[model samples]
Target: MAPNKDNLFGSKKEASLVKSNQLDSTVKEILASEQMNRERKTARLRELRLEKEALQPPPEPKAKAKRKTTKAQE
Candidate 1:
């Protein structure tokens, strides 16, 4: 039996034929997935901000105090 030429040089023609279609599909899928991730992240940040606002405590008013005066001896 003779040695196969496809194995020696790594079959450039066959590789190109299969990968041409695959590259476009993979790129489209990745862009769509990244868009979804960005939307999800934005939603999550908004939810967290709302939750933090709800959890905060309200400010309290300050009280006034009276001072005492000392008398002088003659």
Candidate 2:
């Protein structure tokens, strides 16, 4: 009989650990990609807004009306 017989439960545990590690790495990668995508979208929106503003003409200044002064009677 061989003294170093492979245990089934030990192999299963090792496989489970490997799978968990892979899942964790995959989750991290997905989250990082999502963050990058959000940043890119935000930058694109900001650029569009700036471009639109540049294309529009500036608003004209409003003219102020002169008010008549009234004399107070003593």
Candidate 2, residue 53: lDDT: 97
Worst 10 residues of 2 by lDDT: 1-10
Candidate 1 per-residue lDDT, tens place, 22-63, comes to 998999999999999999999999999999988988657767
Give candidate 2 misplaced runs (Cα > 4 Å): 1-10, 60-74
Model 1: residues with Cα > 4 Å off, grouped in runs: 1-20, 57-74
Cα deviation of 12 in candidate 1 (Å)? 11
Kindly give the stretch of ten consecutive residues in candidate 1 with the minimal lDDT sum.
Answer: 1-10
Quick one: best TM-score, which candidate? 2
List the pairs of residues colliding in candidate 2: none
How well does model 1 score by local distance difference test? 0.88
